[model samples]
Target chain A: MNKLPDALPVEKAAISDLARQTLHGTVDEATNARGRERMISAARAGASKSNGTQRRRRITRASVLLFAAAALAVSLVIWWPRAPLTFVTTGGEVTSTHDGGVRVATRDAESVTRFSDGSVVTFGVQSAGRLEGVRTNGARVVLTSGELHLDITHRKDTAWSIEAGPYVVRVTGTAFDVAWSPSEGAFVVAMRQGSVVVEGPLTPAGVSLRAGQHLVVARDGVMRMGEGTPPTLAELAVASSDAVALVSSAAPVVVSRAPSAPAEAPPSSSVPAIATSVAPSDRPASFAKLVAEGRYAQVVTAARGRGLEWVAESASLEELVALADAARYEKDGTLARAALEAERKRFATTQAGRNATFLLGRLAEDSDGNTARAIVLYDEYLQTGGPFSAEALGRKMLAVRKTRGDAGAEPIARAYLEKYPKGVYAAAARSIVGTP
Target chain B: MPLTVAARKVVPVVRWQTPAELVQALLAAEPEAHGVLWDRYSTSLRAVLRRSLGPDTEVEDALQEVFIRFFRALPTLREPAALGSFLFGIAVHVARGLLRKRRIRRWFRLTDDGEIPEPPDDVDPVSEQAQAAVRRLYVILDDLDDESRLVFVLRHIEGLEITELAACLKMSPATVKRRLARVTPLVFARARNDADLASFMAAPDQGERS
Candidate 1:
């Protein structure tokens, strides 16, 4: 009854080969043995319902031992210690590492501790803190005295926090500066990019600080919270010796504290900014190469230096696409839009150019918050029959819902569900349609 | 010199030649038939599960579930000669259930430790490029619906024939073809668009049907 040809067409065969090579692999003998044992035990247990008590007893005996083994394995996995942070001190002395805790005291120069996830902590001269714990996702730091600068990398499920005296600053991936004096009971936190929550005395409920915000509590229980100016590139260069290049991409922020203003310096001097349009460039010949090397910040800086519009006009199609990617990564929406528009203008008929409309739609919805414009772009992209059609439709539906309410989005949701019943947004569409 | 019948001694060995015979033996509670069934199809089923699940550590558990389910449903299997297809149907069902569970877990912000599949040491290590392609492919698949994802993997990765795919997915051959036609080009286009997988996938123009 198999009437179709055995040989897949050349293209299909090639894809078939690629997928096969990419995915298929051998299951090890040990896993196979374990599976076989489990299968037999489970099957026997099921069969023992009809069989005599002897088989039931045998199954029970085997199951108990299996349960014990599984328990031990799970315990071992749970209690395993994550790898510690590898660090380097620049011309300073640090305490000997014990277990997972290390006291860091910078005497003559600053010390930098780097996490595996690309987060960096730089302790300024005369600063002291102990590494309370380090997990795969984050670390717990206790700042006893002096200043501590954190350029924590943002990642999914990151959990890093800083404790000073009675105050604790919870961080979910952001660059910030914090200073604490145990004797004086003074604490300061300055946010550069992402948001953070600070919990401490007086206001025990915790205060949330966004980018460019600052918080300070004095030794005498006086607190002053206000807007802070981000520091200039020149100030950051003078503040930390070698970290200038690392943090140059950030625009510095400064906040003032009343009681500790004279005794302690503002934490803004060490704040690491996320995306300063101005940064040092490696002068790569192509933006794609820079992106491949993971230097997104530099790509934006170089693109901006060349004039975003100029780069969009003169750069190669590939380079323009790469520039857009870099700008997107750097959270520079204007540059990203410019680059994408350039692709649509120059290589209008090319595959990359056609895909640009979808990316532009995403940018419009996410960064620009132009939901109506986003829907238009999504419609345009969908009409092109591009590869991202499903995603575009999904985004357009959401944008419609945002603008015209759920009732307005229902038709689009129905169309989306019809076209892509198992698409990424299927569940959301189902909810919109009130389907189970 | 040839030995005469009087001087020759023979030992006899018995084996089940067909899946129907194997099924009958299994139904008769012959213990050895279970091993025979596993020995016949486990490797193929394991590879299918591996592709569908994407290097998850729960593959072994899923594999056991397939066998146990197959055993329980053996009597209900109308076409006992089509045992491989029945087993595959169960495997896909189990993989879909696991994917649904994973989605729910993600919604609840729970980490799936079972999702991290252990690297195989027995096989020669894959090149970094191939590994990247694998990751990119799976990420794209994750965006598709469960049925489309399974169909793509079963048809393309597992190299199942259209008939076999229809049997496994419990869809008509026409429906299978339609779904494949819709999804295959889109997936290939996306793969071609991706930087890492672009080199691995055939160029769109080169592979396009004239």
Candidate 2:
């Protein structure tokens, strides 16, 4: 036993004999024969292992290169550019073609379209259209038939244009409604913002419609301006849905640019001249004209029929409101309700929306004897700054008192009196609230 | 009672040949050359493997790997006459490679297929004690880095000179000396903590600071 320095006592040579014995298990002679056989076998195994490693390296390198190439190919497919036509599908089939023309057919269903430039177009039943010349800054389509509600997102750099039978309605951006009825030989464009300019082959002079305006033209190129100003919010109190929209004969929709009425409202915008394209035979008897001629039953009959719905869809706001009265007079509660509902749904934020809602309330109360419905509609109209807010509030309180009594209506009666001191229902409001 | 002499009397392999002729015969992969090299180097290679590794059954496999590598590389040898270093080079590489693998297995808390192999039953008491001390020293030395252990084993136990150890390990002489300096204190400290090896280490009390 000895103390080791800088190393252990387990010296290499000291353990040499033992290790060899332990590993070999024998120190016999004939060792030469044994060693030669083992060495030959081991050498063979080593050669195999080295070859296997080199083959594996080659395989791994090939696989990595293949994977990178595939990824790049997939990247190229996703980013390929300059699409001819972008397909949009709603509830119906979309046919995408190479000619930049996509026809949306809604035979029995509705088709909703999302334009590339951030606009949404919804086609009504039996409506179809072909969008052509699609561009980055605008959507251009030729609507064939039926109705389409459009909402163009606010892109000052873009515009939306739709060619219905005889007229093309063009707008920079706006929420609007359009309809084309060949049976009625009529085309109508209604919009609330982003001035629309209507002109077509039949219209040589294009008409620029400001917000709240509607331009109606017949295939005869006879254009009539329906004083059809839709209701702006401030005008709700005085503007009835039945208020007369100015009647003016507009230029026909034939020429490419049909000479336009001034782009701005000129003070004396000519004696509202009848643009020469107005052909009497090409226009159907309009709803307003039918009503003016006191054909109430005919108006209601047309409003309820499928053939005339396309015409009714293009009815001026005043004509639609008047149609409800005619339907009520004919005792067609369903027809009248449908007429008013259409106006309310289409112009829910406008003065016409308030007017239609208030009248529906009156019809429900008086004609249908549904006081509860009448009360609710009056409250809704009043809340929307109803043109007849003072009246609507008064009617609400009266309806409440008549049905539920003073216990539930004292506050509403007070609200009416407070808003309209000398209103038509002021006397009754005062009585309900116990004021002099 | 020397093992070599006793084994020689029992049996003999091919007669030894001149160094130059032996290298030529070895490169030619002659069975006789293989037998002679085996007879000459197996004992030293086993000792080197066992010291660098530990007393284990794997040492036999490592011994086989060294011989396999040596024969396979015989033709590549620029100076086959210098087979001593070439053979030792194979032994060093195989042994170190096994030690690294064992270190990794321990790091991942892996064990051999089953329980450890039991020592031989015929071992004498003194020889068993010596084997235990050697095993204990290695168990602790495993904690030292591989290069440090190489310097310690070659310099002290194997008795290789600094320059020779450098050449064997493929480092400069200065590097080997620097490694030796670093390993001395570390080997000392760990050896002190190992119950089986503490007795063989000098300055047991000062082991902690060494």
Candidate 3:
């Protein structure tokens, strides 16, 4: 490996010179004049109150007042809200509550809590895990740890739900209760009112529960269905608070349960507490069956009906695509492409749609030589200014370069490189330039 | 008792002599503020700006603009300690914007023969010389696309950390890292060519200052 240099070369020096020149414009005398005029106007406004020789004194007083007011305003903006209170759990989950009722969700082991005013609190996890939600309600939080709980309640015309996770809980105007027990390696969903659908790779088939119904999906794909009792105060407390607080409160509850253990029999066999729901469309089993039986169109129909179209998480979409791909393995390309395209159209106005559009563009470019059309699509994606814009721009530049050759490509590449040198496609641009 | 009293009296003088206070005084439009600030930073600012902007442009005009913008924006500045970064940010923006416009103008002037006019011989060569030194230090920076070059300059030359550079350049740190990664090897290879550059590139060994 060769070493790097300590100084720049003449060409770079010239480029840097040009860079500097391009950056600094002559201070517009007019802009300066405007600034001066504003200042003078402000000063005049200050001086108009007092007459005669006292005008200078009044202007000085007014300036002081203005300075004081400005300082106060700045301080108010800076320190208006107290710093966010951060709660983090062992399994790479974090929650934050602000003075305002805004919540943030971050996963992939680290999460940040930003207040409505943009004050931030960052927390890290020692291990990989998921952070479900970081909810805020006037600085108080009910974080559910190592478990997922969904509580649905009906109030007048609205159905509300509160999803409790290890360090955060999200409340929406819907009803559902979900609990994940790491010990049992099972997830239980019990809807109190309205309807709740739980979707995940680990969710069991035929396990969609209605109000007063409960379903358990085990990690091993076991499906259990039974009548559910409304969550006890103790269970609610455990589900609503942090791990430390829950343990302390759960100790007494465990002690109390020990006395009743003798009288409790293994509940009746008729209820089938762990039996799979018999509904054809209810469970992960059903979805798996749909794929196994080559019912992709049915799966898509079911997914759309369940409002899964609105879900932005790529994992979910990937799961659906995988099912479709598996069911149509002999024609995987056609099915996957169709599924992805349909999903893209379904989500066109959504964040997910934007992502899908980028994916579609990549698929188009790589899978086919429709470079011209792909470039245009990529440009549209970039213009949307979504997270994928930089990537799209890079792809667009490459596509254009490949089709247009050096003379045609250089300007676009140069323009992109100039604007977004650190963009996702920078290496590609370099490759283009480096090519003989 | 006398010594204690004297020490107590000296505390106020020490307390009052802070950069923030001086800045505040300057904002108060005290004549002393200009002199004090100028004495403290004007020479360094001039050197950096002139070197960064090159000699062809009017350094005095740029310097005056920097100060004027600084003063106007001073009241809104939250952290006075970050004044260096703030000034640098302004300089980077001003310089980059100017350079971009110049490029556009020059691009339009390129004839059908693919010929572009050479810069005048009288062009101030100081910035050119500095840029040459920079290029010599990191040869890859010369060949890098404009965006990559700016990121490199902001990160390596300006010595901004990843996050700060990202914010300055309005880019993600991941993007910045990618750019840096792409340029790093080339820069290293170029730097290795020069002994002085090589010394700078060498990893600092623990307890081995020499």
Q: What is the C-alpha lDDT profile of model 2 across B85-122, one tens digit per residue?
A: 77777888887787687778777776543456676576
Displacement of the residue A82 alpha carbon in candidate 3, Å: 61
What is candidate 3's lDDT per residue for A1-436, written digit by digit as tens? 1122333332333333333433332334555344334433433333233243367777889999999999999999866774433343332333333333333333555444443422223332221122223332223222222333332222332312232221112222334445544333334455566565433322211124456665443333333344635333234334422232232322211100011111122223422221233353344556554443334445444444444333223324444443333323333344445555665665566544555566557657766667887887787777674545555777777788788886666776777776455444666776676642
Each candidate's lDDT (Cα)? 0.68, 0.61, 0.46
What lDDT is reached at residue A284 by model 1? 32
Residues A80-106, model 1: lDDT tens digits: 775655654444566765566677888
- Per-residue alpha-carbon lDDT of candidate 1 for residues B1-210, written as tens digits (9 for 90 to 100): 000111111212156658788789888877666666666666667667778877533477778878877876776889887777777788888888888887787777664663544556654455665666767887788888788888888877776778888877889998888787778777777877888777666543343221
**Model 2 over residues A246-304: C-alpha lDDT tens digits?**
22233222211111221121222332322324343322335445433334566665555
What's the ranking of the predictions by TM-score, best on top?
A: 2, 1, 3
| Top candidate (TM-score) | 2
Q: Arrange candidates, best lDDT first.
A: 1, 2, 3
* Per-residue lDDT value at B158 in model 1: 77
**Which prediction has the highest lDDT against the true structure?**
1
Candidate 1, residue A105: how far the Cα is off, in Å: 99
Q: Order of all candidates by DockQ, from best down to worst?
A: 1, 2, 3
CAPRI docking class of candidate 3: incorrect
